[model samples]
Target chain A: MTLKVYADRMSQPSRAVIIFCKLNGIDFEEVRVDLSKRQHLTPEFREINPMKKLPAIVDGRFKLFESHAILIYLACVFPGVADHWYPADLFKRAKIHSVLDWHHSNLRRGAATYVFNSALAPALGMPLNPEVAAEGEKLLSASLAKIESVWLKGKGRFLLGSLQPSIADLSLVCEIMQLEVVDEKDRERILGPHQRVLKWIDDTKNATQPYFDEVHSILSKVKEKLKKLQAERGVSANESIGRTTLHSKM
Target chain B: MTLKVYADRMSQPSRAVIIFCKLNGIDFEEVRVDLSKRQHLTPEFREINPMKKLPAIVDGRFKLFESHAILIYLACVFPGVADHWYPADLFKRAKIHSVLDWHHSNLRRGAATYVFNSALAPALGMPLNPEVAAEGEKLLSASLAKIESVWLKGKGRFLLGSLQPSIADLSLVCEIMQLEVVDEKDRERILGPHQRVLKWIDDTKNATQPYFDEVHSILSKVKEKLKKLQAERGVSANESIGRTTLHSKM
Candidate 1:
């Protein structure tokens, strides 16, 4: 049986998983979960993931959530490609795992929150709180400082010294790419003052260019659909009048 | 060469590592990093782990941090004990890994912050902030809710359905047990209102009684020494003062 991936293109982790599948030449059916309508909370989706989170998978009898876990599972289950994505050397593998663990609590959460509060909120026509946005920016700065000092410092090409991309880069690139979806001012703040990070972002994009193209294509379709829906409701992209909200309570 | 574990007993993840070593009959020399004196921030410690976090290990020139990663490495390094703590079954192992990842982002972080803010600050003769304490409590509640609904919802005696304990149980027991060190009111808030969670905590403790006793005995000794030093400085246990300023910027 072919693998099946349930994802939303706009969600960072979901995009990472999609790109991983594309890069690894794995064939999987993509089931998009509409984040704006909170479809993930419905009973059908809840049956797949009790946590009601995105980036879940079902391969025959096996089911899993947590994007990193899913990525690791893919690497392990598809052993032929493991050398490229998850290296075999004990310390090298551990470093990748360590960086991935760090990313969850640090970069992924901080960047996603900043984008959500500053960009997605305004895009969805919700009121953006300046206080929360400011806090998000502060957190983004602190998170990026650690990423620069600890993970990316002295690493060549890809994270963990991989000549090609690893799951570490996939995990990070997805979240950082969401910066573009944030307000232009916040994007400038993240990409402008942080020269090292900007260079890293460009390098990441170049490294995963093929997977990036596939993801961008999917996202463009999503964008067009969302645009048509908004126009039908007489809402402009910049106007704060739509009912879509990015965050799910559960 | 014997394994060397750098840890402090007061920290939850550190205690978990200590208990795992004792239970597995693995001999390791313990090197305590004094969080009170900020020993983890020293250059010497930074060489071992740039993150400057506890629960790091050195096994024959192989250095590893992150408690879950260390546990996996120890299990892998010591072959006979793998099935007991880290299971071999694919889905079962994935479940354990899933919880470990979730713990880092959720319960572990919140509970550690609570212990530091509520117990450690005042014990060290520093003022405590009610607002920070309140925020910590809120985060702790959200963590507990996730644990109850997601991880422990339909499990057996232990987290992974073991008649004997697993490392999943070991990791979780240490985290939940930190509630003991929290202030009396906060303790009541965690235990009294959350009956199901309270029962899970009791079950985990009972299952890991011997391991828990061994680690807690050493931890109690450390707590006694800290209390004596506080008393010598004439700091009242009941004094509610202003928020204590951290010497280093986070």
Candidate 2:
């Protein structure tokens, strides 16, 4: 049976999983479970993942969730995929795992939550929560600093100083991509201090090629809709803090 | 050189790493970095883990951090350690990886944050934030529901229905142990509904044997201190929502 990936492009990790399969040339069916439509909450999707989460997969009779696991599975299961993605060397693999684990609580938290509160929530009719946005931005900036100081400080362009892009590189880069949906000023403020991070993001994109850009096109579309909503609410000019001008647009 | 472990027992993941080392008989030196004293923030500790988090390990020249990474590394690098802790099979390892990844955003977030805001903060003289505590409890409760419905539903005793405990089981069980420091009524309210989760916690503790109980003895002592703080602040009876009566007792 063909592998099936249930995902929504809007979710960062979901996009990472889809991009990975495309890059590896893994023959899989792309089943979109739209989060905006609440499609993933249905019973059928629950069969794919008992936890009812997105970016789960079904391969033959087996089922799995969590994007990191799916990526690792694809890297290991498919003979065609290269080792640099998840190297066999014991120490190297452990280092990559370190980066992946760090991404969840650090980059993923700051980027995903900040983007949701700053841009997506408003477009989706949830009132702007400046408090959460500010906190998320603090974490987002600190995460970027860690990336610059520890992971990116080495000679190699990718994380852990790996010459090739590993799953950690892809996962973290996709997480940072969520910043693209936020306002340009906000994005610059959060990411501007880390030159190494800016270059590393570019490196990850170039290594993954067409698939990385192909997957991120959805985020761009979301950005446009967010801009229109901001303008309609007069948010861009005056930057009102207390108003709940949010509407159900997306 | 013996494997050197720098950790503080009060930290859940720190204790997890230390116990795993003891249970497996991995030859290691225990160097305590007390979080209570802000020892992890010292420049010397920074050399071990740039992130300044507890439970970093050094073997000869190599250094690593992030408890999940350290656990996986210990499981793979050690020759005599059993395979069930981190199976060689790709699918099984991936499923365990799934549980570990899920633990971060779900169980770890809920247990750690809730325990800190509700109990640890006040004991350490930081004001209690009921708003954040309430949210943490909700997430913690939902996380427990997921544990029961998905991972523990199978016939096997542990998470992912594995007959033996995996690193994921060890990590998450340690996280839930933090609830031991909370108010008795609060603990029952959050965890009482899920008998499977309760049983799984006990099963994990039992499987690990004397090492589990040995490491958690520190928590029992801390629980005593936490209870005293609650009593001193009249937090046990009136349940004041906005009080900084919090003293630096720990």
C-alpha lDDT values of all predictions: 0.75, 0.89
Estimate the lDDT of model 2: 0.89
**Candidate 2 chain A lowest-lDDT run of ten:** A241-250
Mark the 10 consecutive residues where model 1 chain B has the least summed lDDT.
B240-249
Q: What is the DockQ score, from 0 to 1, of model 1?
A: 0.42
- Candidate 2 collision pairs: none
> What is the lDDT for B221 in model 1?
60
Q: Model 2 segments beyond 4 Å from truth?
A: A235-250, B234-250
Query: Given candidate 1, what's the lDDT at residue B45?
Result: 98
- Candidate 1 collision pairs: A125-A240
Clashes of 1: 1
Using DockQ as the measure, which candidate wins?
2
lDDT per residue for candidate 1 within A150-196, as digits (tens), equals 66667576665566778888888787877765445757877677676
Q: Score the docking of each candidate (DockQ).
A: 0.42, 0.79
